[model samples]
Structures are given as C-alpha cells and as structure tokens.
Target chain A: MSITSFIPPQRTLMGPGPSDIYPQVLQALSRPTIGHLDPLFIKMMDELKQLLQYAFQTKNTFTIAVSAPGSAGMEACFVNLVEAGDKVLVCRNGVFGDRMRENVERCGGIAIMVDNAWGEPVSPALVEQALQTDPDIKIVAFVHAETSTGALSDAKTLAEIARKYDCLTIVDAVTSLGGVPLLVDEWQLDAVYSGSQKCLSCVPGLSPLTFSEQAIAKIQQRKTPVQSWFLDQSLVLGYWSGEGKRSYHHTAPVNSLYALHEALVLLHNEGLEQAWQRHHRAHLELKTGLEALGIQFVVEEAYRLPQLNAVYIPEGIDDAAVRSTLLERYNLEIGAGLGTLAGKAWRIGLMGYAARNENVALCLKALESTLK
Target chain B: MSITSFIPPQRTLMGPGPSDIYPQVLQALSRPTIGHLDPLFIKMMDELKQLLQYAFQTKNTFTIAVSAPGSAGMEACFVNLVEAGDKVLVCRNGVFGDRMRENVERCGGIAIMVDNAWGEPVSPALVEQALQTDPDIKIVAFVHAETSTGALSDAKTLAEIARKYDCLTIVDAVTSLGGVPLLVDEWQLDAVYSGSQKCLSCVPGLSPLTFSEQAIAKIQQRKTPVQSWFLDQSLVLGYWSGEGKRSYHHTAPVNSLYALHEALVLLHNEGLEQAWQRHHRAHLELKTGLEALGIQFVVEEAYRLPQLNAVYIPEGIDDAAVRSTLLERYNLEIGAGLGTLAGKAWRIGLMGYAARNENVALCLKALESTLK
Candidate 1:
C-alpha cells in the first residue's frame, strides 16, 4: 500500500495505440486547466471541430470529440442512432466489429451480423446480402480499420452500399482516420468515429466523432431518448456547437481536448495525404525488413492497414517471450494479437509521429537483434 | 480555417470542478504516452485501483477509474446496477440529482424522484417515505455533494435508511470525495462515483468509481446486459482487475490515469482528514470575505460544501462582466451558476490544491477590486 510517485519509463510506443505522441500534443496536455465554458476554451472547441472535419474529410457540422475513448465513441454512434427494435447490419471481421454487434444488442437493437474471418476485410458482397436479407435494417455498421487484426475494410465501398440500401452507415475509423484515405463527404458515411491515440498520436481518452445530416436526423428523430445521456449527440451539440455562446453538456475534457487540438494541428501542418503516405511508406519499409526476417503478415497486402501491421508469431517462437524481450531490451512496444488472434499474431504499428523512417529502421534493427 | 497553435492562458482555476490542479498532476499528465496494455502501465493501473480504494475507504475489488468524466461515471453506476423494469428511488435537489433520474430512465428503470428545492440537501425522510411507499425500489440514488448548489446531503443516513428498506445505495461523490468525509465501508454505501477534477485536483477527465460488494452482486446477477459497452463495469473489470496479466477492454486513458494517480498520491500523502480541514478553513475565510462584501451564499452553513461555495450576485451587478473582469484582470476563473441557478449565483471552489490560504485570500482580494 506504500505507493510513491510513478515516473513512467520513456518508451518508443509502436503499439496498436497510443502511437508515438508528438511532443507538441504531449505539452498541450499539461496546459493550465481551463473551465469548460471559458470563452477561450470555447474558441478552441470550434477550431477542434473544424480540424476534425478536415481529418475526417466531411462537411458534417455535427463533428465533435466524445469525452471518452474510441469504444465509447463507437457506443455513442450505436446508442444514439440505433433505437430499440431497430435492425442493424453489423459487419464482424475482428474485435471492433464484434464490439459493434455488442453495442447494437445492448441498445436493444437486433444485430444481423455479417461475418468475415479474422485478418480479412469485411466482404462488401456479404454486407449487401445481409442488408438485402434484412430489408428493415436501419444502420449498416463496420470497422474501417480493424486494429485487432490490422485489416482495412473497404469503407468507401461499404458506405456506398449502405447508402444505396438507404441504411445509415456507422464506420469505426479508429486506426484509419489519419493513416488512410477516408472521405466522409464523398463516401457518404452517416456516422464515423475515431480514436485520438491512433494516427493522430494524441493521448488516449478523447474520441473524435462525426455524423452526417442523415445520422443527425436519425438521432434527432429518435423514438426513445438516447440510452447514454453523456454520449447523446443532441445534448452534446449544445456544448460543442455555437455561433455565440457554447452551452454546457458535461465538462469537456479541457486538457485532453488541448492535446487533440495539437495532434490535429500537427496533422494539418503535414497535409492529410502526406501523413497517410508517410504511414504507407513506413509500413512498406517495416514490411520489407520483417519479411527479410522470415515473418509473415496475417493480412493480405491489399487488405492490410498501413498504420498497424499484424504478423504471425514465428512458428515455435513463444508470443510472450518475444514481446517481452522487445519491450524490456529495446524500450519498444508492439501489440499482441487481441481476441481470436491472441498469441498467433503481433501488431507492429507505424502511426502518426511513429510513422517515420527512423522508427521503422529502429524497429527493424531491434527485431533483428532480438530474434538473433 | 487556418487555426494556429493554441497557447492557453495560465489562469488560477477556481471553478466548480477542475479547481486548480496540482502541478505534480499536470507534470504527470505530460509524461510519455505508453501502451494501454504495456506491463508497466498495467502495474500503474493496479496501483491506481489501490489508491482509489484508499480514497474510497472501501475493500471492494471493483474499484477503478472510468475512462470518462463524472457524467459517464454516473451513467456507469445506473446502467450497471439497474435493469429494465427495475424501480429506483432518485433524490433530486440540484442539477446532478435530476441527471440521476435521466440515467435511471435511460437504463429503462422507473425513476421515482423525491424532489427537494434547489440549494437544499436531499431529505433522508423523503427518501425513506419513497422507499417505503414503493418497496419494489431496488436502488436509492442521491448526490453526496451537489456541485451546482454547494449542498451536501446526508449520505450516511440515507444509506442507512436505504439499507433498512433493502435497497442498494448509489451515491454521487463527485464534488465530495477528497473534500468531505465519506466512509464508504462504514456507511455501507453500495456504489459511489467521483470526478478527478473536483476535490482530487487532477485534470478534468477521469472518473474514479468504486462499487461495494452488494452492487457487484447486483451487477453479476442482472438478467440484462449493461446498456453502454464502454461504461459496462463487468467487462471493464477484466481489464482493470487481475493478479498478473490484465485483459484488454477499451484502451484505458493512459496519460489521464497518470494524472489521476498523481492526484490520488498527493491526497494519500496529505491525510484525508487534514485535507478536509484545509478546505473547511479556506471556505470559512472566503465566506467571511464574501459576507463582508454583501454577497449572500445560496446554501445554508449547515448543509454547505466546503469545496464549492455558491453565492448570489449582488443587486444589479452584471454577472458576465464581473466574471470577465476577474478573468481578464486577475487571471482567476470562477464558475457561473449552472442549471436553475444560472446567472443568479457564482460558484467559488476551494478544493484540493486550490484549498489554500493564499488562493482564498487572493480570490477575496480580487473580488474586492473587481466589484469596486
């Protein structure tokens, strides 16, 4: 019970998330605490919304950060959009998709799961079939980038299909938002949510969420009050939106928002396309280096996420042993496969600030030495 | 929208919550971002739970910080303990109590609100009457310290009455936790939630939550799933609990937890009773100063919360102007009254790190100058 001051070790974070946080964002987090309704904080909120809009590639005015993590952001989309007795088509390929189904069920919505194997993208054909089979489906939900398996689904195509079927689409862009090309406006995504910790490389906790007019309409016209009041976008709108005075919902995570603002600022400084390309380049370099070490990627090349690479644990090499050696020896953190892929895979992340030549080179050299 | 870097002004935060965070906590927040599942981070997680337990004075193994604000923590308690069709007695005195009713209803539970006037404490007699009138009430919920009105309810007596009525007690300790006396184990409270920003003096995001064995039993035996997956305590326990390897749930707010840990560590170093006395002394000094300036407190002395002082604006004085002048001139941030009391009163906080002689003296001195 004698706990003292914890000075956490500085590590090169290449885990699923939080990826390497830029110094600017980390510094922003320690900024003086401001009242949530302070005029200056309100101004910052307005700019944060715009920055998120830029990152999400959407003109949706309903864009704001949820006061919790990405999982809560995912829940906010489902609980607010999917009312009781509503039928939702949830595409389940990995952990996050399965989580979407859980959200749907928890909200008393009937979830019609469109299943795909782990390490594989959700089949657009299968999703269309599910939507067709359940003609009364109100929402089509799927993860765009599955962190649990490093699989990137065709969000643009899936969103297009959902729109064709007149179903509101909910996309989990947690790992993909700043790393991949996602046009919320062009793809017509009804609701999109992302983690701050991913390619944005901010601290975890704040979840950036955006809802199109269609999704906002559904939330506004909900048959029942939103199940979670803290996450209800309608109420949240009072605080995050304004031409003059912003209203109070819950206390906005002021310092965390500062971190997000700085993260988004960094992303804005480096154009979104350039950040995405950097992630892709880093992924290729890591891919080349890992392949030379006889490691195999679980996700097929086309389906893989550039920010997160899930590779098979070398045959007969212990999962915990290898990860332990890397963490202890190199001060580097890579993800262990989660859910069904646990022990079978390791996720090497190259995200935001971590998506650089030096980080990739260090990871390669470290792995080479650790394996030897 | 060309937004430049946000360099926030350093103000002395004297708001309802987020009352001047400790420098140590702020520095802890800027510590390097680490993997949520990193072994060292997990070790910190275990220590955080223990620190929370000490703060709560509870042996309940389910204690943990919700990765959101107090509002989400409030929702977590309701959504987990309550099932659809369950009857709960909610006490409404101020803003937070009304929110409890919202949570109960959102969870599909029937809320029997025992209303009290604003700025008044929750009536134990009324709560007992409601419980007796409706024996089917499975839970009795109330706020220990009402932030909006600076009223402290008789949580211990209410808990005792609830126990007599065979109902589990759900207490909101958001503003009361590190400022007032709360004996979770001795009082036999079932569930309690607090905010890090309040008396804890941490940056405003994380919510420290603890559930008694009775509440845990209720959650485990529930027939229905917790509505919000992110707030679901059952699933979260797997992530926060464990002897060695913790399971992955949502990514715990890595850096926010660091801030909370430091805040709690600060609390532990300062004896809890000594901290409460400090807040009381500061409140008395502020109150005396305010009274001398003809400012009337909203709550009576007996029911007043030492941490939050709710005082009415003097006759014909513009609320916004005074607050603005204080902010612009003195770099001091005070809270505007919320909900029913909005524009009528200003809340002066003397909690955690802000509960110091100098802060109170400075606040009084600043008010004198601003009013003149």
Candidate 2:
C-alpha cells in the first residue's frame, strides 16, 4: 500500500470548464482550512456574496454560492422552483438546455421544450411562441452560453419576453458570467446560476447563484416541497441570508469558497467591462487565426460566445488523434465536441484568466503545428 | 469595489470538521486544475474510488466521491433509495439524525423516527422495536457518529438489526469514516456517505459515498425518477463506472478530488486502524486534561466519539469569550456547541491530521490560558 501523492501534470486548460485558475486562486485554495462556522469565515462569506453580486450585476438579496458545482446550481433552480405538475418552458439549443429539460422532468414538472438547431442560439421568437401557446407555463429556462456549441443567446430579450408573458426566468450563466456582458438585474433574470471554473477562474466546484425577489416569492409560495433537501433554497436561505450568526446548513466547501472569493476579487480588480473586452479581444485573435487556417465556427459569428469558440474540425482530421497529440506533445487541451457535435467540432475556450493574448498565441501555435 | 485577495488566518483547527488539513492534501488541492474527462484525471479517479473502497471496507463497485459536501451525500442516499410513499425508519439521537428525517420527508417517504436522547447513542433496542412496529419500513437510517453531540453509535449492530428486519441500512459516516472502525461490507450496510473534511484530513466540499449491490438494485428498480438531476445515482454511475469513455454528468471538482485522493493515500499509508488509535490516544490525553480542569463530557464515556469530544463548559465560563481568546491569542480554533448543546458545551475535535499529541497539548494549554 505504498501509494505516493498524486502530482497532476500542468496543462494549458482551454476547455469548456475547469478553466485556467489564477495563481492567487490556487494559493487561496491551499490556505489553512477553516471551520465553516468560524466568525471570520462568515465575514468572508458576506464579502463573497457581495463579490458574486458585483459579477452578476444584481442586487438580489439571495445571492450566494452553492457548495456544489454548476449542475447542482442548475438543479437548485429547477428543484426549488419547479414543483410537481408545474409547467416550464425550456429552450433547447445545446447539451445544457437538454439537461435543463431533464431537470424539469426529474422535478416532476411538465417541460415544453422550444427546440433550436445544435449550434444556434436560443430564439426569443420561438420562446415567445411557446409562452403564447402555453399560458400555463410557470418558468422560462435557457442557457445564456451553451458550452457545448459556444452559442450565446440574448438573455435580455429572452427575459423580457418571459416577463411579458408573466413567467419567471432561470438563466444558466455557467459559461457567461464573467466572460460576457450579463446584466442580471436589468434583464430581470429571476433565478441565475454560474460555475466558478468557467469565467471566475476558480477550481471546479461551488456555483455562484442569485434569486430575484420574484424568484424568492415563487420559492416561498411553492405548493410542493423541493425534491432535494440539499438544494432546497428556502431552507438554504436561512443559512446564507440575514445579519449576525448565520444558521448552519451543509458544510460550505470552505477552501473552494475561499478560492472563489479570490477569483471574484480579481474580477473586480480587473473591472467587469475590461474582463468582457479581454475575452472578446482574445476570441477575435484566435478566431482570425483559425479562419486563416480554413476552420469554420459552429455558431454564427453574431451569436458566438467570446469565451467558448466552437470550431468545425477539417474533414480529414481524426478528432481523438488530434486532441491526444496536442495533449501529449504540446501539453495543451481543447474541448472535444459534446452531444450532436461530437466528432464534428472542437471547442477552444478563452475563459477568465485563460483569455489572454499569450494563451491565445500559444493555442494558435500549438494548433498550427498539430494541423500540419 | 476595492476588494483585496482573501488571506485566511492560520488557526490550529480543532473543530468537528474541516479539521486541520494535511499539508500534502493542501498541496494536492493547489495542483493544476485538469479537465474532468482528462485521461490522466480519469486514471486518478479510478485510484480515488479504490482508495475510498478501502476506507469504506467494501468492494462495492459504486464507491466514488460526490462533488459536494457530506449533506448532499446524505440526500443522495435518501433520494435514491427511499422512493415516494416508502416508509423509512430514522434514528434521531442528534442533529444529523433529524436531518435524515428531513431528507426522508423531502424524498416523499414516511419517516418512522426512533428518538434517542441527544448526546446519547442510538439505542439498538429502540431501533429494533421501531422495525417491529413498522413492517412497511423499507430503509433504516442513522448517524454512525453524531457531530453535534460527539456520540458514536454501533453501526455494525445497527446494520445487522436493520437487515434482520429485511430493511436496507443507510449509514451517515460523516464524522466516523476515517476516524473509527466502520466495516461497510461486513455489516452489510446498504448505503453509506462520508465527508472528506473530517478524519479524511482533506479540504471540505467532496463527499465519499459507497452503495452496496442491494442499494444499487433498489435504485435501479425505483419506480419514480430520483428527485434530483445532479444526485440521481443512475446517471452518476455512468460517469464513475466502466472501463473507458466515461459519460459526462457534472464537471467533477477536479482539484478537490485531487486533495481527497492524497488524503486517502495518507490514510492508507498510516493504516485505518492506526489512524483510529491516534484519534483515541489524542482524545484520552485531551479528556484527562479537560477533566482535571473540571469540565465534563456531554456524551457518556462509552458512547463518545474519539474524533469529536463534546464537553460541557464549566460554570461561569463564557463560550464566545474563550473561543475568541484562543483564536486571537494562540491562533487555535475549537468548535462551539450545536443545536441543543448550543451555549452549553464546546466540541473539541481530535481528527485525522489534527489527532496528534502536540495538538492535544496545545489545545489544553490554550484552554487553560483562555479560561484564566
């Protein structure tokens, strides 16, 4: 039983998530682990919620980080809001949207899926049609940035349409939050969830989430109990909200939360607009280089996500062979296509700390050789 | 908007959990984050499962870490095993047991609670009687070690009793797993969940869970969909099992899993029994010092957990003042009481890497000075 400590190889993480974490964030993670209920930890939590709110651009009082990953954050929204027999309109454009439909079904809600093409952004017109056709719909759910296809939907327009039809909105900002422009409060996004790993430049765990007053009202008036105890936002609110001694819910991934705090702090230091522009600039550089190489983007240029670039693989390129060669030879990792795009497209991410000119140049250099 | 990076103070952790993480584990946590589907990461995942199996003392193929805290692991067992309308017998000796009843109720199961006094072990006689009274009970759930009260229940005997009644057993080994002797396979415990931050000496956020074949069978035969999309064992199994090409569920907490792998590796190096003895030896030293200072244990001596010692505060002692002084003056951290024990007792934990003679002596000395 002489097992030595696992020393993971350092690779350039240019995938959909588990994005390149900042050195400060990694150092924060290695800090002395503290009791979840320690007073200083609670104070830090308060600052974290504030930092998350700044990133989310929301004044939602219920803003906090779930101790799990983005999927749990997605589940938290569905399980807490979608009670049995409730009708929800889910827009399906990529893998995450399909996961949303599954979440609805598992929560015992009736999902009316508005289907869009795999690489296309979710259409507000289609969602409006679904809402107009089904007046019983209680919620409108869609992915802001579809990680699988690099499509960025117009969340503001979608939220506006849902509000016009008297339905709450749940936005999956997992790949959007710090990487793109997302004004949660202005959009009136009722419930929003994002991953720390994608745009926050933190380790993969802990989902930053916020619920508008309307969403809180919906949760408060839920007819049926939330299916999962760990995700019950009503109970979790007691632990995350209010002043003075917060109630204990589950153990907050103390170290991960610390890393998230630091990541968000970095985001704040960089300024949200600069961060978004940095991602866009880096994306432009990578996109131009890839275009010169005869690569085509899966998503249309107008709707393509700045942080996640989904490019089609050349007909003769072996997907696994190319990716493995890149990993082994250059120590670089780009995401393989997910779901319907599998074997057809590649996803190269320019997320958070990884959205730099140096990273973009390295990726292009690596790809130029790998393609030859 | 001017938020500096969070630099957490270094405190000697003597709490119920997030217990003084091993330096190796912390280093592992700060390792370069990898893609969840990275081949090397997958190889590490297999090793993690094997280490977890060894720690669980089970060869259950379903042993893996849930990318959340222990509370979610507890919910996973209840939501996956106790279907809607099923009757589950929950033994409530402390806060965690009551949390089990909540999980059962949230899962839409009828909870037949066998109440034991707080600060006491779950009585086998009462559990047996509950089983006799409730023939419809499909599952039995209890805490192996109650964190709130420092009481350790006999999981082996309890599992035997549940099996004798033809009921599946769900054990909460959150504060027990790496600290005490828990034979999952030998006791026929159907489902078990543990925290990484406890005696595992890892950073918090991940839950190590294992399910026996019988439990897997029950989950597979479930009539209704598991209430949680993220926690549905059937889907999670796809990601954790098989030889190659693991399916995508959620992005695993890559670095946290790295830390857990290192923690379990450390445990394997020390040997589980030796780790348990270290906790016991440290607890005895702490107990003697505490007793000499006129402090008494909240739990009875025979039933107390070695890792978590719930000791009553001496008369005229102010809990907050003493804890604050320790943190400020000596950079030591101890736990405050929880639930009914709140304001009345202090929980002094001797767990995993924190279970050392130096730590024990330091804690006693800090308390001696703080009390003065």
Best by lDDT: 2
* Structure candidate 1, residue pairs in collision: none
Provide fnat values for all models in the order shown.
0.80, 0.87
The TM-scores of all predictions, comma-separated, are: 0.99, 0.99
lDDT of 1 by residue, A1-372 (tens): 799878888899887998999999989899898888888988898899999999999899999999999998999899899988999999999999889999999888999999999999999999888888878997899999999999999988998898888898999999999999999999999899999999999999989999999888888797789988998888888888867677777887889999999999999989999998999989999999999999999999999999999999888888888889988998999888899999899999998999999999889998888877
User: Candidate 2's residue-wise lDDT over B98-202, tens digit each?
Assistant: 999999998888999999999989999999998998789879999999999999999999998999999999999999998999999888999999999899989
User: Candidate 1, residue A316: CA error in Å?
Assistant: 1.4
List lDDT for all candidates, in order: 0.91, 0.92
* Runs with alpha carbons beyond 4 Å of true place in candidate 2: none
In Å, what is the interface RMSD of model 2?
0.9
Candidates in order, interface RMSD in Å:
0.8, 0.9
Candidate 1, residue B334: CA error in Å? 1.2
Cα lDDT of model 2 overall? 0.92
Q: How many residue pairs clash in each candidate?
A: 0, 0
Q: Which stretches of candidate 1 lie over 4 Å from their true place?
A: none
Give per-residue lDDT, candidate 1, residue A99.
90
Provide the global lDDT of candidate 1 against the true structure.
Answer: 0.91
